[model samples]
Target: MRARALVGAALLAACSSVTPPGLVLDVGRTCEDIALAIADPDVLPGWKIHAAALARSDEDPAWYLASDNPDELALRRVPEDMPGVDLSALGGPHEFTLTRGPIEGQVWLTLDREDEARLWRVDEAGETMLAGPQLTGFPADTSTGWIRRLVFLGQSPHLIALPRTTRVGEVPVHMAAVSPELALGERWTLTAEVSCAPLSELNCPLLWEDLRTLTVLDVAEPGSVAGAALLVSIASLGEQPDPQMPPMFQTHIISLTVQRDPSAERPLLTRRDHVAWSTDGPVLPSPAQIAADPLGIYVLAGLVPAPDSSGANATTADYLFRADVLGAGTSGDSGVIALLGKDLRSHLLQLGSRVAIGQRTGDWWHVAPIEGVTIEEGIVGSLEVGDRVTLLRAGRGQVVVVGDAKPSRRVRIACADPDDGSETGGL
Candidate 1:
């Protein structure tokens, strides 16, 4: 580990060529023109440019930022002499969070408006059509219920809305909803709690359980859209041993399955929520992230209690669990396949057969394995075989292979031990 860290530090020192704050371009260039220009390999190789008009600025040639390190960012500019595209506008009136679709060259957008939130599908020509139900009266801020997470499966987008607590008379009541099994390009009905599945009750007292993050594990019979499974993490207030002490919280993970409704025509969907498994104590920290694979589900969270003092922060670790063995409030951490170190960061990615874990210390970046996988030792940032780690700056999705910046980077991992030389189970 020490040797690998040292090599990573050296590479970090060598890759500090670009240094600036904002991207200044020719006066006539629109954001669309810049996006098209960046796509050309001759202009910007390996880097992805997400084009959108600056929220606060309506002028041409908006500002853009880049970074040698994800944390130590710098705004760089395009030379002022380049030609510009003759586009009329950069974006529409409404603001939205853009994400890459499951298929290549496809894009999904979530319009964030004050009165409601809606999903749309954007074609290559930049035309958009409604993809899912509009979340009416959803407060865009953290003060009220909002769209927490969005997962795309085989062209279907599932939305999980965050829970909102409100006072019913004098008692606090929780309310939450979702748009499940959304088949894009099809006419679908939109209801407040229709997608909550078996818990679709209008007054289902979601109680203190606040939805955090979720990921779809498997779509049983995806060809027919027969059924699907997902893992959801919920957080609730923990017992207060001392009334004056700061409130504590516990996170719980549950498995939800949705199947085609037999009674309804046109393959309507129905779901059932169950406690597929449980871990002892408060293992998961608040606002944990979950992702699914063939082996099982992996959660990225703090393995240790958070620091009580203010102004102190620490990175979380990644834990992989078996999907088959988990069931009925299982006790202990027996399901855990691996427990990564605290120094490792979240956002685990399946590059080839192995699950990659990213770590950044100061200017250096390291990619390591978190499960039954093996990566070449001393490998930093990019892989030894030229599989470089780059952020997919074009969308809100996880890291993809290339040289753009999002939250983390990606690399491939081998599923066999170099010493014994046998194939092992991996994610």
Candidate 2:
């Protein structure tokens, strides 16, 4: 408890995306379970795979060297230095299928662009390029060409994707396990790392504390019992800097796919999906209709409305992430400053013309001044019971010089008036 308090204090002193917390579970028990699980010939097992040799792992075939088909050998090595635009010899059209179960997929490697590891799915319906782990109602995220690692878990296949780091001595950030099941819920968990590197700048350095979604993919039941849960790191700064202007923010999302199973009683991790770029807008149809997409079919994997300041349910009407307008002098900075201030406390602010909040009682909204909001610490404040706030948007309490548009959503705070029913702001 003391250590947690200290960490919380440290977080209060500076902005941080994620801090190490007590093991979401203990390490010793988790390791033993995972060892026994991988003891099951890896998550995606049973396939005698052939392909250009890939980085190998004895545990699962998902990490084994792979190739295009049964007859042809995959290219293990590429030319040291090649001229531009040669797509012919990059690598094989890699294919994979479970010797059992309903798993089947393909990849076309683009050597020139490592991140563009093209992915596809082939099923009874037909074969088509698989674009993403697009979540419901949210935007679909595409990746640059790179696939560092893959693992498959559970009775139904769920994937875990890891990133490549050059340091040989580097330690892993996550662990997972899976149990082969005969039922709809394929139990699995892959301790895969989720980082804010793409969203936070180098100086900010937002690495996840611990984020994973345990997806229950009920194949027999289809959407009936399928759902996802997410725990993403908040955008945090390693060190606070002098604030000259409000920080600009943006959102970055990842496309995930399920690969391998670890053992039993572990977290289920989704795979990172890679797709070629699109000029005609998003590359796939609305996730709603996409077959095999865990997200479109399952309920989104994260908490809604996000916990509030007091760790209560949030009370937000609507919010939008806004980047600071470049070249707009101090006048432009005013709106940015207010929007980033304490929640409903940004009463003395305006964004795109709307910048007023009030005290609420039933359907009534009473207008108030910035000073009218209840000050929490004399530094931080809240929209108190009877208080309502309006602004262009309310960020997660930030004055970012830089930020993202992702995982950022508006939450409505429930109004709980004071017992005395005393009114402060004018109605």
Candidate 3:
């Protein structure tokens, strides 16, 4: 570990040779990007990034601060509201405040002995616990102590599989969304080595310095993802990859063209409140609504296959779940984000689908939908696909299935090894 840490520091120095000296951490990049950026060829990847830290840094890129060592760091805990088991019986004397038990919120862990480790809550409960193998049951590279003592407190043990290497630099790592906010993928980078840079000086921010360690958060970005509230006419391209345009589809691509008039079937803006977008291209729309005459506009909407896919193009439903509306948009290519109305959203999700483009006279462009768009709780709409609708977080023999970020239904989950328990068959 010590040798790797030194090597990691060397790699960081190498980064400075390539990157400008003033900005050690590229604030413009995502946490995942920065994490991979600072990785050494032999460093091991970590499971999670500090969410709170990322959020803060995003708001203030200049405020890149150092944090507690991730190895010595405790994993965040499940929300008190989130379902979890009561392992209060698994108590100990090494625990400074064993009374509260291993409660919820952000946390940390340390080895108490060879057989047991301590779990500490960084929240109000101030709980703690002495855990065993089942707790460290995650599949990390034991050689580097990746998942050795650390355990994220949750209703169920979740396993996060990572890649053996990384596509370092500003490259995009395709990922499957676990929820709207969380996506899962592997970092095919080197074994990780933590860096030893102090924060008091103008040393690179702790967050970026972390990349110097062997940690790569499993997240996604297709170079960049830009969303727009485009009002498009729905249709399907032919059943094969169009010969001239790099074979876009195998079984008829879900296709679209710009629709100008709101009266004759319009495009619905996405996520935000407004609804105008560019008709001349697949460029994402700006915040303010901009209306342009939607005549004679043609942008080639291509469904680039997944990084490893070589089969038929996605099904109509599949295409919608992986929608990519951004493009090298042309001049006069623009749109808005205003609310075209609730009914329009419904029409696009349900009614507006399966129809031919509104005005069929000119060249056509296309796009597809990705999974889990937002909708109000009580008033619902269909996300449709089963896999896209639910995601899993695994640990040991345990798994957690999240329906969606804001699921309306009640959920329950239980985990932990029962053999070590005193009561029953190890509570």
Candidate 4:
């Protein structure tokens, strides 16, 4: 019965562009399950998928896959029927998506240009709705390309264009929000210096962070978006590399919440809250897709194993990882959790909360939470040293469960009062 239900969910996701909230995971599911659920359906081999937008055709809710080929770009409707417009003239689409707007679905696209960060809104047939007056203060870098992402905020409808770093190691620390009307000459300031030398393999510094995905929720007003989340990937040099082999890169994940101050001349985007996991060794964590629910944020990612002592590579492990956003007070008795290995894939380490299911090659451990440890039960636990854990949410009275399977042994997630400096030992 469970297998049948899983298949139905996968089929529904494949047929629709919208990601389901409860599709994060269940017991006995792996990370690849979520990855495949959110992955784009197979398009023609040459075309690179740029974005997935809501289909403009119906009220029932469907999606269109926008892809780019060497010659031009096109939108292929899901379930494969409706013919879409040929967008060859858009000039190599950077970021494009359809958002709920003045009418219903507005197709927005950003162009690949050096002087200006171009924003274009077109119809389902690819005819322009509004086009002009490039976003001001866009970096004019000829050697490198800039990537942009767009999202709609509230009923008053403010369109936000977020900039990706022009080069690796350079984090674009600023964001902009434009009203429904495409106001001209908006400016952005750079908070960090671009130090990455893409060509120089050995000398270029490795510590870097890049934005992966963005989600907005609980919009109080056109200017006040309460829970705007950004999934970021942070990379650093794992181990000193041999002169011959390329350096091993260790990647980590970060969930950042930014607040918008609408009162500023140009609405300022500032960090409000963040959850990060400091891990040991070099594990290449690649988060391909991310989304959120009322509970927390979830990421479908590929975690590549660090190179062994022999310097040989291993297959990447796909897993779905969750970060607690809502506190236990609202989420009820217990929340989903899982225990993952330090090496990305191996024997399970200290049982931790948050659901993380890996590839088939790893053992799925079963464990139970020790009750009466705290009012939140064993949900709020102390993070162990060298374990990939994020205790940042515990300060907010959040509890995360570690394992999903019905197991015999008892495992306790220690509790710590962030304010009082009080902690209970793990069992």
State each model's CA lDDT, in order. Answer: 0.33, 0.21, 0.19, 0.34
Better of 1 and 3 by lDDT: 1
Q: For each candidate in turn, give its C-alpha RMSD to the true structure in angstroms.
A: 14.6, 24.7, 27.1, 15.9
For 46-89, candidate 3 gives per-residue lDDT tens digits of: 32212211111112111001113433322233322222223324
Stretches of candidate 3 off by over 4 Å are 1-123, 126-154, 159-216, 219-427
| Candidate 4 segments whose C-alpha is farther than 4 A from its true place | 1-50, 55-69, 75-86, 93-103, 112-115, 122-128, 139-145, 155-172, 181-227, 237-246, 261-287, 304-319, 324-336, 339-427
Measured by TM-score, the strongest candidate is 4
Which parts of model 2 are misplaced by more than 4 Å? 1-233, 237-239, 243-256, 261-427
lDDT of 4: 0.34
Cα lDDT tens digits, model 4, 370-407, are 11110111122222212332111110011122222211
Q: What is the TM-score of each candidate against the true structure?
A: 0.45, 0.19, 0.18, 0.46
Q: What's each prediction's clash count?
A: 7, 58, 49, 11
TM-score of candidate 2 relative to the true fold: 0.19
- Tell me the tens digit of each residue's lDDT in model 2 across 1-427: 0010100111112123342221111112111000001012111122222322111111111212233344443322211121112223444434221111223222222121233322222121232322232112111123211122223333333322233221111112232221232111232223333332344554232232322222111111111113221212121111224476433221122233332324835543342211111121111111100112221211111111222212222222111111121212111121111112113222221111112222223222223111111111111112222223222111111110101212111222112233534322211
Candidate 1 — what's its lDDT? 0.33
lDDT of 1 at 426: 14
Say which prediction, candidate 1 or candidate 4, comes out ahead on TM-score.
Answer: 4
